[model samples]
Target: MGGYCGYLATVGGLAAGADAAYIYEEPFDIRDLQSNVKHLTEKMKTSIQRGLVLRNENCSENYTTDFIYQLYSEEGKGVFDCRKNVLGHMQQGGAPSPFDRNFGTKIAAKAMQWISKKLKEFYREGHVFANSEDSACLLGMRRRALVFQPVIQLKDETDFVHRIPKEQWWLRLRPLMKILAKYKTSYDVSDSGQLEHIRVSSPW
Candidate 1:
């Protein structure tokens, strides 16, 4: 979730009243800035405490097309004893399994319900929101029900729009994706939809 999906997640998380969004900090590693490669001292840790660090002037993960972000690294946080996990290919390209199907159905149903409710409210209030800024309401989950969120607290714009907020819980898990990405066979081992047979030594 480091690209467009990441952006949407950040905006959605903010709209949903999150304290802060977890984005990759600048200078993920000091070695990225070196003209010639030196011995890499900053090693990847297993815990959130040691895995992330503070953003430095040399970090490149802080940039976004639409919004500026204040990113922090897992190393800088000094929270060691990190644990990492991934759901892998099934999440990206595999067929939808039972849990995925069920969860998707539930979320989709709630989204439709929110849109219906929005149109009904708009009709009754005689307010029409045609612009993206006004109509782009953030949808969120409140308890078991799907709720609406506004980024800028534009009460007037809420007259018409349905939007689902981002999943911050998942957003927080994004860093692990990068850490484990080194081991994923999909990155360099797989080419032309065929997986290579040789064993990979180090992705880095």
Candidate 2:
């Protein structure tokens, strides 16, 4: 979920040429994380069994009891108790914020404009193309959308080929590797409590 949010935030920032980014993560402690992970892993394994039992019984009371039992056994009593006051209904009751409504309208307008422009460009290129039924292909709003043709074979032979030159690959990877090394060193120090053992290596 963090990764997905990060990706969306990055794309939105890049599209708007924003100066900075903000990030958020699910609130959790080390113990909470461990408990959640263990519970989820075990629950997944028995999910099919529970589903089958619920289907066979076909009673709301039995299904509810089984679900509570599963949650209590795996995630402990806190989660089980909390489930009693579930916020499922409250989540759907809020009014749409002004920002959300404005953003939605803006995105729709931009999508229509982009699709119209792409259609015009495609026709002007004198390339024989059939109208696509797929909204995604017809819309041409994908990441790096303008860099490729609709035909897969043609796309591969055109600008898509060698888009990343050797120098470009090295330029991207160098800083990423450096950051990874720094993180590794920091992690080692945190784990062993040995500040002197941490060493930095130059990439030259």
- The 0-to-1 C-alpha lDDT of every candidate, in the order given, reads 0.38, 0.35
Tens-digit lDDT string for candidate 1 (1-204)? 333234433444344432223333212233332211111123434222122211112214443311121212233234223232222233355677897798778878877887786676556456755444535666656676656665566454342322222333343443333334333222323333332353535556
Give candidate 1 misplaced runs (Cα > 4 Å): 4-23, 30-91, 124-135, 141-146, 151-204
> Taking the tens digit of each residue's C-alpha lDDT, what string does model 2 give over 39-102?
3344345522121110111122233434644644565433223223222235343678997697
Q: In order, what is each prediction's RMSD in angstroms?
A: 16.6, 15.8
